[model samples]
Target: MIEDQLTEDDVLLPTYGPRPVTFTSGAGSWLTATDGGRYLDFLCGLAVTGLGHAHPVVTQAVADQAARLTHTSNLFGTRPVLELADRLRRTLGWDDGRAFFCNSGAEANEAALKLARRHGKHADPQKVHVVALDKGFHGRLMGALKLTGNPAKHAPFEPLGTWATHVPADDPDAIAAAVDDRTCAVWLEVVQGEGGVRPLSEEVLAAARAACDDHDALLVVDEVQTGVGRLGEWYGWQTTTVEPDVVCLAKGLANGLPIGAIVARGVAAKAFQLGDHATTFGGGPVVCAAANAVLDTIESDGLLAHTRAMGSRLAAGLEALAADSPLVTGQRGRGLLRAMTLSGDFAPAVADAALRHHLVVNAVAPDAVRLAPPLNVTPDEVDEALSRLRAAVADVASPTGASPTGASPTGAAPAETDGR
Candidate 1:
């Protein structure tokens, strides 16, 4: 177990509240803890490791690039970056598109917001405000944080520099009412991953598109968590008929490597001039090479089709489980990105129980559990995850079970209830 007893604060910043279990290694759909126990990794690095941990092709590409060239910065061009950019254009179906690379999802969204503001300023100086959906998450950076719709996350860092407004999601009328002449862009997520895995309905998506068109405002879609086949497509926007002017992507872009990108088109593409936006380690050779390998592997191995099939199977299983258990109310989201709504705030307890059963899942909300397993997760592995989840649910729903909220299990089945 490495035998180190030092607390997190002793050596690291107090930015994250990580779990106590330390994993030593991972491969495919499983992770081995430092204590030599293996667990099914459904979290997949918070949807970054879509190809699974330590993927062979990505690992080889990283190794080769490290031996050849690691970083040349934005001062000089690199072949890997150029090739990867070209591939992204084709994959994303952007004919007249431009790409800006960064190190994280927030950076990508920040660049998009900046580009939209610049585009608006170029048209008219009064167009400075941007609109985002309620419950939408952009990033933690200043510009991105201002664009985020969550009030609690923004309350602490008051007086955000950017002039942005938040509107209710799935309501076109609300979007139309909020977006005016001063609005430069409308930020949206096809699926709200952080906000209980809510997917935008087709009518609501159409409303956002129509409103942007009517206002001459840029439609900026954030695909940070739902992009790269997580939603059974290359990009979440591709699932619907609406088109966005700016698309932000990150997370699974490089299969766990730190990479983020913004793809802009038409006026938005021309908004940024030389020195308007740049980054030091945005598209270095190593990460770009890793990203290229990810794209190639996804296409060559047909992970997209696999993701759709597996996602359907997983959703069916979840639906059946919910039908059998009163504790579970319903399910939402698309493809591999799915969530189960609990009757009470038992998500943390269920997650803890799953951990004890040697499985990894995330409590995305107080009453919601999200699942974003690897795209290549085998059917057998998914079956195993379902089994573990059932056991975890049973353990938490037992009559004598310990509840995280210190409340009795109101939805618990009778003592003789059989497994669903």
Candidate 2:
């Protein structure tokens, strides 16, 4: 008799490759695999769980809200959803801001895309074109995918429409030239998460802002990966000189919960009227309550200041690693969102090595290893991650075992403390 085998390919679609490890549970900055082995979580599930896994506050909020009400659809009002919208507006510092809730970054971008088109069609109908930067990644939905600048992701699904024009990320003049009377919005990411963790030049950002002003177009910032204190700020755009009319947020808003929101101010706020767009589970009470808990924890515990301090420590550690290693070129990016730039395109191998050493990180680009730990990450945790990363580097860059390192390949015991 043949064995009854169950595999990821047997029941699930192969959108992602086969998994190597199965996690049983997680707490702040640490994950436990099925084998009872512990791993240091540096990627934070693609920078989504800024507050880390199983946060007490968020867990409690979810329990309370679920006990009271799970969902009521968008037709009815919920206190958590209403309070969440007001809280988001307060964080954005846009008193006149309006929000549309959704399920993911892609949906947030989709809603913004439709709103931009609505705003444009209201004016002349010909002003529907969008200007976006190359290497920018908004989302994977149809309209959002078109706004995304990478041609590789778009190649699989062609006929994405020619509404958007992509230009070089650092070229300010080209961005200025791309916006014309036909443009309705200029899409950009302050820090390109999937495009090699590159930060846009202030000149390019300023040019986009200026061009939008001149053409009467909306400046929509994709804050999906950079929002909710990932960059040591409320939003990445807040650290830049240019102010945007609309910003799409997701990822860290509700930690691991599926939540997305777009906050629009000024004329952009009025672009979408009642019934312009809607979602069933977007503003559900449970998720909104979870998001409120996330906000409350960040504010009450002062994660912003803690993230800044820890970011500095992490940055300094990476710099020290680069200085001592021959393979690493240096580091780029700011705050907690950082990349270890390598001299060669061996980021995948490095990431694999990191995984083998029980560290969770990923290759944001061919030559960059992205490290985005939790916002309230402790100093000891940061040091421990650096140690593991160094060991990973030693294993890859120095296969002969000549490299000097501090951490053990067998995985050292993590610090006992869990939260900030």
Top-TM-score candidate index:
1
Q: Candidate 1's C-alpha lDDT? A: 0.86
Residue pairs with colliding backbones in model 1 are: none
In candidate 2, stretches whose alpha carbon ends up further than 4 angstroms from where it belongs are 1-5, 400-420
What is the C-alpha local distance difference test score of candidate 2? 0.88
Report the C-alpha lDDT of model 2 over 1-420, residue by residue, as the tens digit.
Answer: 233367788889877765768898999999999899999999999999999999999999999999999989998899998999999989889999999999999999999999998888888889999999888988888998898888977998999989999999999999888999889999999999878779998999999999999998999999999888888888999889889999999999999999999999999999987788999889889999999999999989998889889989998999899999987888888778999988766676677778888999887876788999999899999999999989888886664432122112232322111010
Give each model's whole-structure lDDT.
Answer: 0.86, 0.88
Model 1: CA > 4 A from native: 1-3, 403-420
Q: Distance from true position, residue 93, model 1, in Å?
A: 0.9
Backbone clashes under 3 angstroms, per model: 0, 0
Which pairs in model 2 have colliding backbones?
A: none
How large is the C-alpha RMSD of every model relative to the true structure?
A: 4.3, 5.8
Q: Which candidate is the best by lDDT?
A: 2
Count of clashes in candidate 1: 0
lDDT of 1 at 44: 94
